[model samples]
Target: MNRKIYISLAILCVLVLSLQAACFARTPDKLPNVKILATGGTIAGSGATNTTTVGYTAAVTPVDALINNVPELKKIANVSGEQISQIASENMTNEVWLKLAKQVNTLLSQDDVDGIVITHGTDTLEETAYFLNLVVKSEKPVVVVGSMRPPTAMSADGMLNLYRATILAGSREAAGKGVLVMLNDTIHAGRDVTKTITDRVDTFRAPEIGPLGFFTGDKPVFYRAPLRKHTVFTEFDISQLTDLPRVDIVYHYANNTGDVIKALTQAGVKGIVHAGTGNGSIGKVEYPAVEAAQEKGVVIVRSARVGNGIVARNGEANDDKYNFVAGDNLNPQKARILLMLALTKTSNPEDIQRMFWEY
Candidate 1:
């Protein structure tokens, strides 16, 4: 009687195992399609030795190698890759930004491509992410991911970061969340996320607003959504443009003479983002140069060098008096991006200031 009971239990276990196998086999068809647009960064970097995280050659690895290195990605999404560029994020240029944005729009417009994961270097990842956030023209999930450590380093984080990014891009929960920057398992809004630490793995953070979500399981778990305008809601369109208007950032310091501002204006930049002191204050020494540039019809946006805080219009500096636009919560680099796009539509300070607040 005992032997017969054991036989029955064994048969039941086999039936359960078979059912699980069948379910697993059918999961691929149900998985979301995710496309990886690889622009080279530290995530694609390689080092001379395992401990050599710094001074490593970046953009050494191709998109296919990155995908194939992580086998787990196959279980969560139907993944494919395309090489966008093979340069470090610091070398990221307006030409590449235009190309990337156009390609992203083209891909997300297709029905087959459900979402996109962009592999970038941490140096300018935030900038690229913010650029796409405004111009992607799709509600589909777009995740920008990178690693501080090279793939060959000890406890290398690239493959895992890429995997989590793939999961995020393919997730239904990640849709309509704006472009996201994922690193160290944290998901941040592209417009708000910035690299806070230079060499650490947990470098990216949204200082004032915090992260949009995190990767908790097979899918990304959300805690909040971005309140700022982004993606499909933005008015900046770049479809016909071959190049963006030249915008430059000028850093402010004690006794600064604003020589750089004058040079930028003479060079014919359409706009300038001043990385001013607290609350976007212009040094008394440099004020005239700023005014002179503004007189030339070069848009001057006052952005603070401080990491977190709003550069309120008419606060420390008299924006109304100077005809200067405040940078809102955007950092200097991001402010430059917005100013570039803003120049495309209107040069009016009021119209551009409204964009500073809205976008």
Candidate 2:
């Protein structure tokens, strides 16, 4: 009887092991992991009262509060937060950009991290998004999110914007789309999206090319793809870059003395983006100073101050003769970004022009 009992116990042990293995195999797959890198904006802003909207302390809210207030996020993915900085987007600098890029690349290299979401200020959100669109080395989704209303204000938009951004980051379809800007239930390519409104939640837009897609009924939908080359396809790599080349923008206006252009040249800027008026034409008064700067070895790129349309190559002015490259639909701020990166690689106008067209 004892021998029989021992054999029975050994058989039960074997059966238990087999059942455990089957249970493990039948379990559902783990959710995608997402990281939220928070750089304060109005989304985290707090005002004196819930009724106050405009005048408030920006970047005062912590990442933990931003994440904890939205409990529904856990149902979608394993989300984590890190506070990179606490400042308004207007104060965003090149140093923060380099630090953020390095951190993003490091996280993307890890096998467990699938995607990333950035909480930024709407003021300079597009600039950061475009900068990341150019330099981030990974194909994983990087969605920059922000809100026009302060978190303390009525009808606050941060909760939903953050929710949509988190969902988009975890989406498999978001891969290889480069950096994305998700706000007002819309998805835009980082390279083209720009803030169109100052005080509205639906501020971001890509005029030449509309949004890449949108989020509806709690799901992300894609109706188009960005035609421009981005992410893994581009040549920018910021891993070894400690400092970016200095570039500035000078806007042209009637009766403008071009004093800013002369001052920028004296300040030893490597490149200048002339925000010319009406199809990127240099006004008669601003022409001599710009020409002088160009002759002083400062690369000048002509970009239109108008909200829409491209600065046509040799349309209003002879860019070839003056060695000035057309902005190619890139706004002045974005042109400054590209020029800073392009100057790092090559100073040749032709090579820089090709970079502008391709990127």
Candidate 3:
């Protein structure tokens, strides 16, 4: 065989391979044609050699395994998965939330993808969902699903939760509901939902503020939709995160120490959340340090150390004078979450408060 002819044949084969790869990526043969973004939650896992499947981690389950385990999904929609991360939700960072929000926004601009599903660990599920709800620009459903137990555990709740989330994503009824947390058979607004129990299959609930709805026999049943305003797919692109100002959380507790207040100021933290005691109250001991930190230019937010209900300002004097803001109904931790996101848009304490009110 001539050497030149052999070389020419190899080049021709390489070109064919490139074309084939491109065709597979762009072709739209998959069903209901939905997109599932997997973030390495318990819903996409199996049991280990021991532990009765109760404990789980973001292991090696790819996107296909989720659909394959629940073949009944085939009758509902044509879905595909994009493995985004494998870390537990507790470790999730602002950067990851921003990235996820941007990715969903990009997909929503496409004409074919009907909805987006996020599979996440239950620990910080609400935070991720809320982050998406506040930022992803779409009336198309962006549903977050997680299981209380690992799939290998007996009576694992992951499968049913996944099914419910899938139904919500495919249904036209879920439009304009914002990002949702579908777990324990309930559909909760992302920011309003929280994990009430660490071990129960029904670990998620809406507190005094209840779920928006539930799944009844593969159907989404809505009772009350949230009336809050959101800014998804708006000018709130996460690409703006690069130069965004910082936001921090300050927790108020009985005799709360001022260590964080002093530390954050040194770290140049631009914002602070005080998870205060009753009604976002700060202890006398911690107040001066926080006030001093704020005097130096940090935005101080008073949030409840308690987990439930809206936090508010009562007799806490000079809160307005000191340019401090109340967390409203958000816990200190959650207040931190919303504040960081809001700070991406503006620095004025007043404007940041309004962003919270609107969202």
TM-score winner: 1
Tens digit of per-residue lDDT, candidate 2, span 217-310: 7899999888788878888889998889999999988889989999999999999998989999887777788888878789999998996888
In order of appearance, the predictions have TM-scores of: 0.92, 0.91, 0.86
Kindly list the per-residue Cα lDDT of model 1 for residues 129-206, writing each as its tens digit: 999999989999999999999999999999999999998898788999899999899999999989998899988998
lDDT score at residue 149, model 3, on the 0-100 scale: 74
Extract clashing residue pairs from model 2. Answer: none
* Stretches of candidate 2 exceeding 4 Å from the true structure: 1-29
lDDT (Cα atoms) of all candidates against the true structure: 0.92, 0.90, 0.77
- Between prediction 2 and prediction 3, which has the larger TM-score? 2
Candidate 1 runs further than 4 Å off: 1-26
If the candidates were sorted by their lDDT against the true structure, best first, what order would they fall in? 1, 2, 3
- Expressed as tens digits, the lDDT of each residue in 247-282 for candidate 3 is 777655556679879999999998898876666677
All models, RMSD in angstroms: 6.0, 7.0, 12.7
